[model samples]
Target chain A: MRPLIRMAWATSRRLLLLMSPLLAFYLALMVVHQVTKRGTDIPAIAFTCMFMLIIVSTFQGLTFDVEGFMASLPVTRAQLVRTKYLLSFLGLLAGLALTLAVAGLAHALAPGRAAAPTPEELRSAVALALVDAFGLFAFLPFVHAFEPSRGILAFSLAAILALAASLAGWGLDGAADLFRFFQRVLAQPAPALGLIGGLLAFGLLSLSLSTWAYARRSF
Target chain B: MANLLELRNLSKSHGAFNLRDVDLAVPAGTITGLIGANGAGKSTLLKLVLGLLPLDGGEIRLFGEDARLGGARLRQRIGFVQESPTLFPLLRVDELGEVVAPFYPRWDRATYRRICDAFELPRKTAFARLSQGSRMKAALALALSHEAELLLLDEPTSGLDPLMRRDLLDLLLEVIQDEGRAVLFSTHITSDLERVADHVAILKAGRLVLAGAKDDLLESWALVRGGEELLEGPLKDRCRGGERTELGLTLLCEGAGSLASLLPDGALQERPSLEDLVYFHDRGKESLCAR
Candidate 1:
C-alpha cells in the first residue's frame, strides 16, 4: 500500500472501531423512524453532520497523544498532516454517503409515500452537506494544529454555541429576510461561485496557518 | 570513523531544568547505555536526537546526517522506543507491523515475524489491552522491524519485570550483533547496562559526570575504606562520595593507580562495581556529606 493510503487505512480502521456502536445506534434510529409515522430526511442528515463533527474532532485531535509514536515513524510531518486531512475528507464523504443512502431508502420505503428528492432538493442537500462538512473541516485543523488540548474543545464548544444561536435566530422576524436572501443567492450561480471562492480562501488560509504551526512546532 | 550518532554542544532548557552544552557520541557497532538519575536530562537529550523536541542551542548528527535539519530520509534509518508504549489503541498486534511497514523502504517483515515469535506476542491482541511488558515488546518489535541502523530507546525497560527485562535486553544484544547496528539506550537499570553496554555515559543533575568504557570506569574508580584521620590526611581529595563506617570511611575515588601514592598504608582500595560508580557519581553532594 502507498504510505499515505496505509496511514489512511490505519486511521479509517480506528474510526470504524470507535464508531461501530454509534453506527449501530444510527441504524436503529433510522429503522425506528422509518417504521413509525415520523417520515423525515432531516433527522438522518442532522445525525450524520453531528457525528461527522464529533468523530472528526476527536480522531484528528488524537495526534496530540500519539505525537511520540508518529515521530518514531520514518514518515515526515507533512505526510502525517496530509494523511490526517485525507482521512477526514474520507470521513466527511462517508458521512455524506450515509445521509444520502439512509434518506433515500427511508423516502422510498415510507408507508404512504413514493416521493423522491427533486433535482433542486438533491442539489440543495449536496450543497448543504458540502458547506457544513467543508466549513467544519477547514476550521478543525486550526483547532488541532494551532490551539492544542483545551483549545480545540473551547473552539468547538464556541462553534456549537454559535450554531445554537443561529438556530434561535431562525425564530426572529429578520430570519425570514435572511432566508429570502439565501434563496436569492441560491437562485443564481453567483452564490455557488461565491461559496466556492470563500471556501477556497478559508481552506487555504487555515491550512497554511496549520502547516506553519506544525513546521515550527516541537513534536 | 564517523560515529553512528553524535550530538555537538546540544543544549535545551526547560524552565528549571537545563541541559547545558551536552556533547554525546555513539559509535557504530556498539550499545551505549545512558545512565542518569530521575529529573536528569536523559529524556530531553533523547528527544533532541529523535527530533521530537527541537534543540535550543546545538547540533545533532545521526548516521553522519544532521539531525536538526534532517528530512524523512534520515528518519528512515533511525528507530525509537519511548518509555511508555504508545501504540494505536485499536490496532491488533499483527496489524501494527503491517501498518508501520509502508513508511520504511527497508522494512523487514521476516525479521519482524521472528521478533514476534521470540517475544511470544499474540497477533490478535489490541495494544491497549496488552500488559506493560507486552506493550513494550510490541513497540520494540515495530522499531526493530524497520531495519534501522540506529535505535534510540528511552527507558524501554522501566516497567518490566526482571525476566521481561532480561528478554528485552537479550533481544537488543542480538539485534546489535550485526556490528553495523548501534543503540543509545537510556535506562536506570545499571545491571542491564553492565550486561550489554560497551560504553556507559553517566548523567547527573543534567550534566555528564563520567563517560567512557564500562571496564575503564569500573577500573578507574575504586572504593576505599579507612579511618577519619586516613580520610583527612592524604585521601581527602581522592575520596569520592561513599558509605560511612564508625571505625572507618568507605569512599569511591580514582583507582589505586591514580591515588595509591596519596593514600596511607592502612587504607584499602577496592574496585567499584558499575552500580557503585553510578551511586557515587549520582549522589554528588549527599555521598560526599556522608563522611
Candidate 2:
C-alpha cells in the first residue's frame, strides 16, 4: 500500500475499534425502531447513517493535535487534505455497510415483524445510501478545513440550514407552484444535467476554499 | 559565517506582554541556549521560528530563506520540541511512528528503533499514560530520529530527572559533534548550558538583552569585592548588583581589560562563569548603564 494509504488505514483502525460499540448501538436502535414502527424501508436507516458519518468524521478525524506537532515534516498541504478526504469517505462506506448488515439481519430473523417492503422501497434504499454517502463525503472536508473546534459548529449550522431549505423547497410545490414547474424541469435529462452541474460547481468551490484555508493555517 | 537561522526585528505579543524587535541568530553547527525567566518570550521566539504563531512584525529566515513563506521542503530541514506541546493521546508508541514516518522523506526506521530501544519505550503503551519524564524522552526520540539540520528545543530538559537530563544533553552534544547541524535550545538550567552551549542568548521582558559566544560572555566579566570606596566612586558604574553585606560589597564588572585598574586595592578579580554572566545580565539591567 502507498504510505498515505497505509497511514490512513493505521489511523482508522484504532478509531474504528473505538467506534465499534457506538456503531452497534446505532444499529440496535435502528432495528428496534423498524420492529416497533412496522416500517421495513432501509432508506431511513441509511439516511441516519449519513448524519452519523459526518458527526463521527468531524470529531474523530481531527481530535489529535498532530498538525502542530508534525508540521515540520516534508508532507505537503495537498497530501494532508487528500488523506483526510479519503479517510472521511472510507468512514462513510464503513458506516453504510455496518447499517445494512445489522438491519438486514434483524429483519431476516424477525419474520412477519414488518410488512414486506416493495421493490421501489428497496431501490430507494440503495439510492439514498449512495446519495447520502457521497453528499456527506463531499461535505466532510470543508467542515474540517475550518479547524476541528470551529468546524463542528460551522458544519452543524450549514447542515441545519441545508435541511431547512430542502424542507421549504419540498413545501414550495403546493404553495408556490413555480417550484413545481422547476421540479418538472429538473426531472428532464437536460435540466437534470444542469442540476448536477450546479452541484459539481459547488463541490469545486468548497474544495478551493478548503485548500486555501489548509494552506494558510499555521501548524 | 552566515547564521543557520536568523530573526530580524521579529516581534509577537500575547495580551499585555510584547516580544519586541527580538533579533537573534545561531551560527551553523553551534548550540545556542536561550535563557529567560517566566513569560520572557522564550517559547514565543520558538513558536515564531516554527511559524506556529503569526509574527507581529519583522522577518525570520531559516538557512537564509524566509521561514514564514517556506514550503514543505524547507520545513523538512527543521525539528522542534515544544515546552508543553499537546501530544496525540490516542496513539500508541508504534502508532505514532506510523503517523509521523510518512511525513519525512528520509525517515530512518533503524534510527527510530534505536531511539525507542534506548529510551525503553514500550511499543504498545499509549502516549498519554507514559510518565512525564518518559514523555519527554519519547518526544526527544521522535525529534532526533528525523535527522533534521536544525533542532529547535523549547525547555526540553525542564522536567527531567538528573540522569535523564544528562543523557539528553549528551545525546544532543553527540549530534552536534557531527558538524553541519545546529541546536537552538531553551532552558532555565544555566548549568546545563554552561556544560555544552557554544553560545548563549539572554532574553528579558521580550527583548534580547545580551547574546554572544559563551566564552566571550564568560571571559568579558570580572567578579570583584571591596569596601565602601568600591561602592562610592567611579567604580559604582562597574557594579552589576550583588547583595550588600556588612563585610563588603560583591560585584560583577565588564571584563578585566581597563575595568580592573580602577578596583580598590585588595579587591579580588575572577572570571565569571556562563551562568553568573547570564544571571547578572538578565536580572541586573538596572545596574548596567549603557556607556
Number of the top candidate by TM-score? Answer: 1
Per-residue error for B151 in candidate 1, Å, reads: 0.8
lDDT of 1 by residue, B1-291 (tens): 459998888788877988988787899888999998898888888877877776789788888888756766788898888888787777788888888888888999998888888888897888878988888889889889987899999998887888878988887898788788898999989999989998899888778777887887887788887766555665677666766657667777875577777777788878888888888776553654554
Docking class of 1: medium
Residue A171, candidate 2: alpha-carbon lDDT: 50
Give per-residue CA lDDT, model 2, range A25-63, as digits (tens). Answer: 877787877777776757667667655664555345477
Q: Which stretches of candidate 2 lie over 4 Å from their true place?
A: A1-8, A28-39, A76-86, A93-147, A150-196, A211-219, B226-231, B238-250, B285-291
Model-by-model DockQ, in order: 0.55, 0.44
lDDT of 2 by residue, B149-188 (tens): 8899999997788887888888889888867889999999
Best by lDDT: 1
Clashing pairs in 2: B220-B255
What CA root-mean-square deviation does each model show from the true structure? Answer: 3.6, 4.9
Candidate 2 lDDT at A120 equals 51
